[model samples]
Target: MTQNLGGILLIRMTSLGDIILTLPAIRAIRQHFPLHRVTMLTSLEYIDLVSEIPYLDEIITLDRRGKEPAETIRVVRQLRQKKFDLVIDLHGKFRTRLLSGLSGGRQRIGSRRDIYPPNTHAIDDHFQLLSTIGIQANDKSLEFYVTEANQCFAQELLNEKLLLGDQVKVGIFPGARWDYKCWPADRFAEVADRIGKQYNAAILLFGGPAEADLVSQVRDSMQADPILFDTNLQIGQLAALISFCDQFVSNDTGPTHIAVALGIPTIVLFGATNHLKFGPLDPMHTVIRHGNSLDRSKGNDMMRLITTDEVWKIAEGKLNSLDK
Candidate 1:
C-alpha cells in the first residue's frame, strides 16, 4: 500500500508520566496513517519500553538530562541526518524547538507561545505549540503496550515471592520524579500495611533505581504483617512485575499510568497536579486529588497534605471492586 507521508519524527523527550501518556495519540496517528513510518525521539532509559510499541518504526534515544550543550548538538545532528518528512514537537520545549528547526523536515508542527507561570499542568501548556497548525488536543489519556514477556516475568516474580495457591500481589509505586507530586512514604507504608494484613497480599514497591531509597523507607515503616517485593529493575521488568499485581497504588507518576493501561485496578494520588486535566481514563482507575484547586505549587507541599485515611479508603474501594 502507498503511504501519504514519507516519514514522521515525533519528539517527546522528558518525564516518564508524560511520555507514557502520549501512547493514545501515537496509536491514533498509526490508525490514521498505517503506511507512515512513525519514529519517536525519547530518553535512552525508556528505549526498551517504547520499542515494545508495535506502532513505532524506530526510536532515537537521547540523554536530554545532561546539561552540556554539546549533548543536544549531537542529537540534533543525528536528527538532521534522518531527513524526516515531518517533525512533530510534542515536547514543545526550547531545546525541542531548536532541534525541530535543524531537523531539515519540509514541515515543522509545534505549539503556540506559552507564557504560563511555573508549577502549572505542563501538559496543557505543551499542547499550546499546536495552535498555529490548527491541531487542537482535547484529551490527555495514556495508553501502553505490554507484551507476553512482561506477563510471564510478572508471574515468575510473584511465584518466586509468594507460596503456591496464594496469588495475591499488590503494587505500590512510592516515588515521584517531581518532589511536589510525592506523598509521604510513611503514608504509603501505612496503606501497604493495611492491604497486606486485611487481604493477605504481598506489596511490590515499584520505581527505578532513583526510588530505591524511598522504597526502602516505605518497606521499613510497614508495621502490619509486612511482606514486600522491592527490586531495582528496568522499566520493562518493572512493568512486567506490576502486571502480576491485583491492584496498584501510586503517586502521579509513570508506573501508575502503565498499570492503568494494563487494565489493572489503579489508584493515582494527585497532590500538586490538576486531576481534571491529567487523570487516568480507565474504568477501574481512581484518582484522589487535594481539595484545593488553586494551589498549583510543585514539591511536597501539597502532596504531603493528603491524609492517610483518604488514600486508604480509595485504595480499599478499588481493591474490593477488582476482587469482585
Candidate 2:
C-alpha cells in the first residue's frame, strides 16, 4: 500500500446501526492519515447522517433499487473519475467489489468474502479493514453530534407534550424491525408501570411512524399515561429526545444505537439475533438476553423467555443509583 495520503474513499451502505458502528473505524482511518481527503460512499438516506463528522471530507450517494448494471457501470465510471489514492470496501458485496476494483486506486483493501467468517462484532470486523492501513482501533467509542437545531426542535415537541423540567424520564422503544426481535408490548407496559411507580417517572415512548401501532399498544396497556412523541421527528431530533431521558430501554433496533451513542443509560433486550455482535458498546449500558437454552439463531422464542421482573430489576438498579 502506498503512503501517498492523497484522496481516499470508504464504502459502506447499510442500516443505521451498522453505519453508526462504522464510525470508530473511520475515526481511526482519519487519525492514521490526518491530511488525506476522506470521502464516504453511502445510500442517499444516510448522505446527511455524516454531515457533522469532522473526519469525513465528502459524501457521495448511489441510489439504486435491485439489479441495474447500466447504472452500476455509470457509477463505476463516476468513482474512477474521483482518482482515489486508496479505496476500502467495508461492505463486501458484489457491487462494492466491482466499484473498488474499477476505482483505479493504487491501493485497495477489502475483506475476502471467502475467508471471512460470519456474525463477528461489526466494530471488530471494521478494525480488520483498518489493519491494512496500519491502524488499530484501541478506542472503540461510537460518535454523534446533537446540533442546536435538533435541541430546539425536540424542546418545542417536549413543550407541546408538557415534558419539561428536571423530571425523571424513562424512555422505551418497544419495536424492532422484525417482529421476532421485539419483546411483547404488554410486557414493556408492565415494566413501565413498575418503574413509573418507583420513581413517579414520565415514561417516554419512541419509534418511527411504522411502529406507532406498537407504541400505542404499549401505552394502552399501561395504567399510567406514558408520553408519546409524534412519529415524524427526524433522526437527529429523536436523538435529542433520547438524550433527555434519565434512562432508556429498547428492543435491538437502529434508534437504540442512536441512544447508546448519546451516552444514555440504555437497556437493550435481545431475543432472536445474537447480541454478541450487536449489543451496547458502552460498558455502563445494560443488555438483558434471555437466559434459557434455546438456540438463539433459530427463532423468536427468546423474547418470551425474559420475564418483565428481570428487566424491572435492572431498570430499578439504574434508577435507584441515580437517586444517590
In the order shown, the candidates' Cα RMSDs to the true structure are 3.6, 2.4
lDDT of 1 by residue, 78-182 (tens): 888888887887777787787789888878886433554444444555545444444455565555666778667767766776544455678888887776788
What's model 2's lDDT at 141?
90
Give each model's whole-structure lDDT: 0.73, 0.83
Structural similarity to truth (TM-score) of each candidate: 0.85, 0.92
Candidate 1 ranges beyond 4 A from true positions = 1-3, 65-70, 112-141, 163-166, 225-227, 293-299
Whole-model lDDT, model 1 = 0.73
Which predicted model would earn the best lDDT? 2
lDDT of 2 by residue, 1-324 (tens): 445668999988777787898888889889888888999888766665677677899987777776477767777788888899888888888868878898887789985646545556778888887876787777789888888998888788888888757779999999887788888999999999999898888899887879888889998999999998888677787888888889999888988898888888989998867677778777779998865343545436788778898999999989988853
Error of 2 at 51 (Å): 1.9
